[model samples]
Target: MIGALLVMIWLLVAMLLLLRRSQAVEVVPSGSPDEAQIAHHLLLDASPTPLVLVSGTTVRTMNRASRLLFASDDRILPPPSSLFDESATHLRHAGRNWRADRVEVGDRSVVALIDIEAEERTAEARASAEMIQVLGHEMLNGLVPIVSLAECGVAAAEAREGDSALLGEILTTLARRAEGLRRFTEAYRELARLPPPLRLTVSIEEMIDDLARLFASRWPGVHLSIDVQPGLCGEIDRDQMNQAIWALLQNAAEAVEQGGVPSGRIDIRATAGDDVLIIEVADNGPGIPPDCAHTIFRPFYTSKAGGSGIGLSLARQVVQAHGGVLTLLEPFPTTFRAQLPGAAALYGTGSVF
Candidate 1:
């Protein structure tokens, strides 16, 4: 919605500039062709959004912003259709998301590209600031007590007259708080330092089975089911993907356990379609709270007691590393989906289904 508004404002500005230029031409009557061309270029270049004028698939011209956007040694722009594929208003290129808007003008079209990724990053920075405040509060909650207890323990040791049991209790509490802080720091470190995926072809069914066994061992009371399309496979980092999927399963099992459902159940399904691998995990348990739907994936955010809150965040990071997305499907039996691209290459050749 914001991208559309920005595009509309820029287009209106361009049209108004053109209208004013036409009026100037009429008033002066002696404006040279070179002067008019320079004015046209200036009008397009003044806007920050990348704009490209194309005649069908051929690139007629583009401003400086567009040139920089589609930077190439030969200075040739890709076809507008290629950049903005049918039904795709969003394009991911050069590690950034662009909102593409194309407008037809006579025999040509003008494509406006807005950097929506910048807006997303701005919002994420805001959220991170808030998370940092919460983190500081949590750290201080643990640290203040630890410091006080350590001081008491030190005074007791120096005086040599303090009760032995009291000193032992103080030292024990200090060790526990320090261990908690260490684990807290370690979870954040894991979330921040996720390595690039080492892609390899693996049978989808086998992976799911392995995960099912692990889940069953961990949550014996929770019934787990797995369904994978026969002969389906994927080119992904096996260990990393397993960790990602296991986190999802763990979350579902924990939700079921917490909800105290009479018969807790988790169903995992995997399918390959349109060169993408889709994995969905659904659980029969209390669904996510409406308020938490937006922030569940944020690191260090959780409602559960003793929850480090890195499970979903780590899962998302792993999927993103494999050039995929992890999203929650709404309005039902609490489902999470992970879609990984390049599934066509991993189908049918290797059996073990």
Candidate 2:
């Protein structure tokens, strides 16, 4: 009887311990990371494209980019369906146009946002090419007859022994207009044919100083200041980069004049980054109108009367061909920023730092 009781008591203790272990296993704290969940989180966080997992309308979780984009505390966002239809539509968020898509991840849906800037650029390039072809066709056909007619008028007046002054004036005016149109079309064509940058090591500081002095001489009354980080340099096409900077400076100066600001100020600044060199041109002028912001980079879109509208477009094209980007910084309404890859980054030699 004593052995039996001892064995029974031991068995009872074992059962109790087993029961406690099972209960402990079942009671996982809410939201505790499992192997798969942790992996998904890491992948989403590392992805360049912004992503968010939504459980119905409430955002179950999101990566860093999502927080930066929404800028709101509410995790429960309006359904993606509201913003996007069956087809991927553009949503202007955070000052960029993004095409959002709904994707299924397990039972939940994830919203994937892709930036369409490159696509826009491709489209713009195609449109510019088409326009150039049309312009060339139209201008050639139109100018030939005008030139021929003007020549014939001048000849007739001279042969008839009549006063040739009127014909002379008409010929001169026609020639001037034709030349101006030719130059205008040529500018657009140049943007299309912007040569691949011939890269060479150049001091960015020198470029800044030179541009400032040149512009100051051109606009004697306007004040131009340069702030360049010492010992900063980049590998770039010298003449092309000079042209780009000159265009930016000229636009800023013109903006100041148009705004009619009493004390016009234009500031040029340069700084070196780990993998890129940044140059900024800012002016105290009436900034680009918000309404025209979308079309500002489009070829032949101009705000100024008599403006060819190709200056900014060409400047941007030149920068892009060099594997850099030129953008209008909205934070400073009249600021244009250019980011170009550093020499090390361009050549793949070593870290830019």
TM-score, prediction 1: 0.73
Off by over 4 Å in 1: 1-47, 51-98, 103-110, 116-131, 158-161, 345-353
Worst 10 residues of 1 by lDDT: 72-81
TM-score per candidate, in order?
0.73, 0.59
Write one digit per residue (lDDT tens) for candidate 1, span 46-114. 888887666645664377777776774223455535543535677766788888787878876677888
In model 2, the clashing pairs are none
Using TM-score as the measure, the top candidate is 1
Q: Which ten residues in a row have the lowest lDDT in candidate 2?
A: 344-353
Native-to-model Cα distance after best TM-score fit, residue 270 in candidate 2, in Å: 0.9
